[model samples]
Target: MGRKAKHVLLTGGLVSGLGKGSVLAGIGRSLQDRGIVVNVIKIDPYLNEDAGGMSPAEHGEVFVLEGGEEVDQDFGVYERELELILSGKNNITTGKMWKRIREKERRGDYGGRTVQYFPDFVNEIEEWLSSVSQTTMTRKGIQPADVCLIELGGGLSSYEIDIYLEAFGRLRSKYGKENFLHIHLDVLVDVLGQFKTLPIQDSINRLKRKQLTPDLLLYRHKNEINSGAKVKLSETCMVENLFDIPFLENKEQLCGFLSKSGVVECISEQLKLELKSEKGLVAEWKRLHRLAPEPGKVVRIGIVAKYNINHDAYLSLTKAICDCARSLRYSVEITIIDAEQLEEGLEAAIAKLLIADGILVAGGFGVRGVNGKIMACKHAREKRIPYLGICLGMQVVVIEAARNLLGLYDATSTEFDPETANKIILKTENSKENQGGGSMCLGAKKSEILLEDSLAKKIYKNSFVIERHRHRYEMNVEYAEALKEKGVVVTMVDEKTRMPSFVEVRGHPFMVGTQSHPEFTSSIFTPSPIYCEFLKAALENKKCKTSMGLNTTNE
Candidate 1:
């Protein structure tokens, strides 16, 4: 039989949002650099199948996997840092687990025995973890290496968290101490001008009482931990691998610090795994880090979205802009404008949009703030400011052009108004049949650029491209000719359905929209072409302003 897989369980102690996800991603990347095949799993305690239905303000961005599974935003960090493709299995929510258990119970998998939380529910979770580990071991034809890194959601004191820890204890006993290592992350805050460690001490005490002793204690602090504090932590916690991690300013610094830190060595030693030289990985990371753009000019781009309350809702979009700025050697400042507020009055929204070198309309569901998005698009068009729209944003752009430019004031998406005569945007046939399930188009699809001189075509420099999509409505093909005659250019179409995938204003400087999401594929190493072009246009606009001696400040 093959050797048992090694497990690294990471849990938060003192508080939430203690950079646990970032630390986990860093550790996973470090291990991978040492030729270790690592799989990362996040156990969210939320009672949702996934994060898709949750509001971004409550839970941040819902990262859509290539498999179309919507997961927490940490999956984005994991994918970016580790450079690995994760799936639905990588994310396990409380709702998903319970659903599976209930289904199995209905199928009589327990053989009429009374189903209980312990020994039944707990065993199910253990089995699920084992299955995920085994599947990940041989994923993508890689050599079978049993090293799984699991991150528990929320703090240790929650009722749901206690249940998870109980299962974790059972797994540790079953797999042996050598196969399982627990790393606890706690925060050190400044109190009375001194870095207090009592909160962490109390947290560790709570864990000990629950029979879960941490092998490593990671201290998150705003500033450096003094020698006295470090000694005190060691003496109190009795953890040899005590790490003090200060909040980093940027990804480059974080990667460099993690690579040099001895955290990876301690973990590898505890798991009894041989470490390989990371010289190549270190050089690659340095090269990426050096790609950071110089600080000089600031190109402000306003992103108008309904979920502006939480900037993380558009994390991928914002990150893509940052990546593009780095590649172009241009600095960018992103401002989130609330679309709901814009609906109250365009005066304030226009003021915000005027300050931006470029404007972006982000994707979202429902009709709450859609009119505001349309108004923002109109402002971008009339002002000739660079504009980029995504998904629902694309739909609104078409609607705006149809109404204002095409002289069809009644033009609106059927999604917003089912009774509107000009149904420029119509629901997909499947969506019409089933109002709830499998209606929306999801996942990756291929597209072909139809217009040679369009902005999208120039950005991609390819006649054909593949991008991920998540939307239910599409531009009506019957109005395609009408829209084109009205100065709206169709740049791309789906290779299979021939649906309009990209559109742009004919004479505008950079007004463009995409039915598919380009942000999902954007990464630190490779910025999406559309975003690269958009930022380039914004930089040019900024330069143009400077050349004209125009005041650049928003005020």
Candidate 2:
């Protein structure tokens, strides 16, 4: 806290979703690899308190922090790139800031003074950044960040984000420009097979209008950016620090790409930091990637989701599986089986689910696709195929076991069917936790998982562990006695609530479910214990099929 943390601002112009998050994380990783204690922050300029309730179809994925905060999907990229467990405090939002202001106003903490935007809002952002800077998140421990990397959500033209621009400008003035570096990212659109430069010039002008200019310009393109286009942007538009960012297959590849472009060296010099390469993060990343097994050994995974059409809805869920598979040296061919599609009929659902080497039903909402997910769980249970369920998916596993094994046919979740007498999965009686999304969330400090000699223990390698959660319904205890008597046991439990958080079926090939979400915590360097073990089972299933003369894949 003694030294002020250096700030690197990353803002996108022309449009959002240009992979600006990747660039920000790439820069952070490049510095962290060089022995700098860095912290990354993501500021979302939205009205929603948090990203928990946003539609996957619209907002892509809702990334849950270890603290149980549901943030934008970019945080997933940040965690993976930075290789650090960031707190929900790292994710700032307009809704969060305004909510605090309104709360203080209602409590008469503001002293009834009519608050204006300029000093008030800017002061709020600055204070938030100061706290974040003082306590940087790292794998080793919490400490003051040497450099703080912030990814400003939305675009330069976004009206909601104009306040951030003004606040950043004011920050530059207060602290001196030497303490801050601005990276403006833009994409070169391929219009009729020709790369455009005029739009890039316009974005620069827009930045100038906001009284902020880019020190480093990170640009994305469909193909290699033409040299002429680059010259025009640099000479004419006065964009001196231009860096070309290309499409890379792996998320970690971004830092290496920028390193080869000499972008890392340029940044360190501009920031005036001692350029010392420590363990070589880029080198280690590329080394691991080069050793990945070929796609010859494929693991077919079927993900049952209500929003199957939107892959981003389950971005972390899918990424966890993919990352785990890569760690075990296997390729994954994911099939998004719509839960609603599975509801047409049990037979229809089975036919669709037959394509999976391992079946996974991720978290979801409502009664709309509840039956389909149950059918998928049933198929996996009966066929003895490796299966993993999460959140709503976990509830479906419990429901399936009750109906088939315990003979409770009317068993259902209160969330899906309130009228059902046998509610296997229902909302908590007294406590209030969204299971895993929304404005308020349980922090990482509270979540606990107590494991036994089950698969959960094998994967986690600990009798007690911590993970994330995102669900309204939990595993009910009313039917727990009978279910446990039938070899369906709750392996891991919420330490405080004593609620069943993780479930595993005995005598099954590989059946596991957890009320908490493991996908949210899985990282490229260390895969989520649950996901890693789940994929390992699928790999074994693949090997078993190959040994018998059965096709390894349904396709």
Candidate 3:
């Protein structure tokens, strides 16, 4: 029999949005560096089955896994930092938990006893944690090194959080203290130039009331923790492992900062894991950090989307653009424009679009912002501005092409106008499936580049590629010949489904759209090719404007 895995529970106190996700990623990376196979699980207290239906404005971005699960944005952080592939199971929500329990009860799996929340619900959570950890280990085909890091969402004082604490305490007792470690994260603010510890002290007291004592206290502060404040925290909190964690300027500094502050070492010791030197990892991080672009040259890219209010909704897309810009040694300035604003009028939208060196139409659902996105796409296409479209954004490009170029005024997607001549048709596989939620085509799939002289093929530098997808529509094959008759080019198609995967405009500096989401696979180390090429073109556009000395009103 294999040794049981160790568990680390991280919970936030005082306030939320204290960079808990980043801190968790740093710890996971450090553990991975020490030859430890680590798996991370995120516990969200929301009633939603997944983050897919949540408003990006409120909950942030919904990260899509290769398996097509729309999860919390933190999963993207874990993937980017640890360079590991995660699945839908990594993100556990209260709604998912309740759904499972109710299903079991409906099927009489609970043996007709009244389903209670205490032992039954709590026991289900623990069993789920164990099952997911083992399942990930088996799937990865690696040696069984059971070290799972679970992050509980929301503030420590909330009732939702109390339930998790109760379950965690029970799990600790079942697994033994040596096998469990709890890390508490808190915020420190400067009140009139003096560091305050009262919030965290109160938070710790609240935690103790729930029978949970933190093994480590990670303080998120803007300034340095003075000696007097440190002593006060140590004495009041009764935690010797007190560490100050400042807000990082960039992702490159995460691993280095964690290592320097000895937080990684403290976690390693508490988890009973051997500490290995992170010299190699640190050096690589520093190398990349030094490669960041200097200030001055800025290429502004405008993102037109429905969820422009909350930038977190487009976290991966924004991150991909940043990563690509950094690699090219140019700073990128992003301008987010709500597509609904464009629907109000074209003059205002065009003014904003023209100021950008390039334009990107992001993927979205529903017909709420479709007209506005279509307007933005048309402006980018006609103006010869660098453009990249994704999913619904790509469908917008096809619809615009059919209407403007091919003279198909009635061209539309069945999703928005089921009665109109559908230029973007629903796939046969998805035709009978109900709309919305997880019913759409999801996960990683393969596509082959069909055009040799296309921007997508040039950026990819290959005939074939695999990209993550999360959409229900595809380019209508019936319009392929008509679109080809114009200047529109079908650049790529899926190997199995023969679905059009990529499209481009001939003679444009850079105009490309993809059914697959290249942003999902993008990382700091390896930027997505589509974004890279788009940013590169934007840089050239910026240079042209600088040389010509034309200052636009939007800038």
Candidate 4:
């Protein structure tokens, strides 16, 4: 329908985890800030339809966006950096790739020909990118925006990513060179006090071998870009110099670097977009500051997660939590507590726990540090502290309550209950024997939340609601009636299947556990309904503590 699509593919030369996600995010933000509507797609090399059922420790938490698609963490980066919202369509893994190919074959869409990897597989990727970018418009929905940024997961050298590289090369011919911009992300190592371009040089050489040359190279490192390295790189790679590092000391410097490279102006001129002042986007970031409470009075919330250091792991959830914080006009401070680290004394953990007005145990798979999360939830419930649980988090709370209150000492999930006689976990009839990826409800599955006149209803303020889910193990239905008798209110259920979706205590200050994930529903302009309530509770708890302290002081 449209003339053609402007495309940008990001690939690396060396290994994985090279900050390619961040560079793409930065460019996405810079363009969107200048009033250029940007769309992003993540092409993961894994051979799964979705990252579902993958360990959060290994594959990172699967992010669900508005359209019920499970995407990569880059979607979160793009949302935070550019302040735009995307759906699962934004993320495409090799797993998701083959799924489409096999479906087409099943439908006889391949015209009875044996569909092999080369042309058929490669064409699926190109078709996916074009279809997604064209359909979901970021702003105003005018012709799929000015540019679509696509990030290739893993490195360019990986055989898994080779198909993606081939697709891009074919796309270049189809869309024309002017309609596409290739960006290669790499690091600039400062070895022995002199910048070594060997790493970057090797990366570029590999891309050249693939017949895909980078239009711009984003060098991401914790150092300055010296003139000599820039020249050597430009002459060798024939790339437009666009160095991106997080060393912007001032506004003047940032504006200068952006203007000098003609990044904003050039993009504007090429895409026929109006170059609005950077202040428009800068103004949006300032809104975050304005929403924060006074510095010392800010509330701290503890995020007990499996992968605490990998901030990318909790991208969408963190953004939703922050969005909730901003909605309540309070500056929120997040303390990352690795679930593995909580094996230490509960007395020692009390300092951090007491400092936090509210505690959130995020979603994760496996049993590596599950005991810590269960312990944290128990402390919150027993201490009457505000708490929120999501997905597997809800399951953890149920198991915790059963063990401590209901006298089930060895309650565990089916995932970990291979030979244990006291395993409280049960397997889904279909999922019990499935292999890997995409086993769970990775997409949007609607479960009716019949909010009773309890704390759950007060926070949600709605009787019936539906949300997304991505997990294999759930509170076993055989044990569900028993748990319900022990005062665990099943606040929500799937109308058709009659499965539990949310559970909570009868009366508490603030506590909720939902089998559905509300993080995917959160956006920049609109916070997730659950997160909004959680932030309100956290802020209100802060206010109540402040009032009580003042009263005691006056007495």
The candidate scoring highest on TM-score is 1
Task: Arrange candidates, best lDDT first.
Answer: 1, 3, 2, 4
Residue range 293-385, candidate 2, lDDT tens digits: 766677888888888666688888888887877777887888888788778765555555786789998887778888888888888887788
RMSD of each: 2.4, 2.6, 2.6, 4.6
Candidate 2 lDDT trough over 10 residues, lowest sum: 438-447
Distance from true location, Cα of 43 in model 3, Å: 0.8
The per-residue C-alpha lDDT of model 3 at residue 85 equals 80
**TM-score per candidate, in order?**
0.94, 0.93, 0.93, 0.82
Clashing pairs in 4: 47-95, 48-95, 48-96, 49-95, 49-96, 69-88, 293-331
Residue 185 of model 4 has an lDDT of 77
Deviation from native of the Cα of residue 190 in model 1, angstroms: 1.7
Residue-wise lDDT of candidate 3 within 345-443, one digit each (tens)?
Answer: 866666777799999999987888899898888888887778889888888889999989988888888878888855455554664556466767788
lDDT of each: 0.82, 0.79, 0.81, 0.71
lDDT of 1 at 294: 66
lDDT of 3: 0.81
Error of 3 at 429 (Å): 3.4
Per-residue alpha-carbon lDDT of candidate 1 for residues 1-555, written as tens digits (9 for 90 to 100): 776568999999855788788888878777888888888889998787877777877778877777777788888888766777778888988898899989999999989998888888788888888877753522255455558899998986677777788888777778876789999999887886688878889888877776678888888888766788888888888777888778888666676787778888988888898898774665576576567566655789999998866767888889888877877877888988878878888677667766888889999888999988998899888867789999998998899989987888998888889899989999875565644323567777889988787787788898899888878899998888888998898889999888899999888889999998888878767789999888878877777766767545322
Minimal lDDT window, size 10, model 1: 135-144
| Tens digit of per-residue lDDT, candidate 4, span 481-547 | 7776776778787666677778886556788898887887666566787887777777777777777
lDDT of 2: 0.79
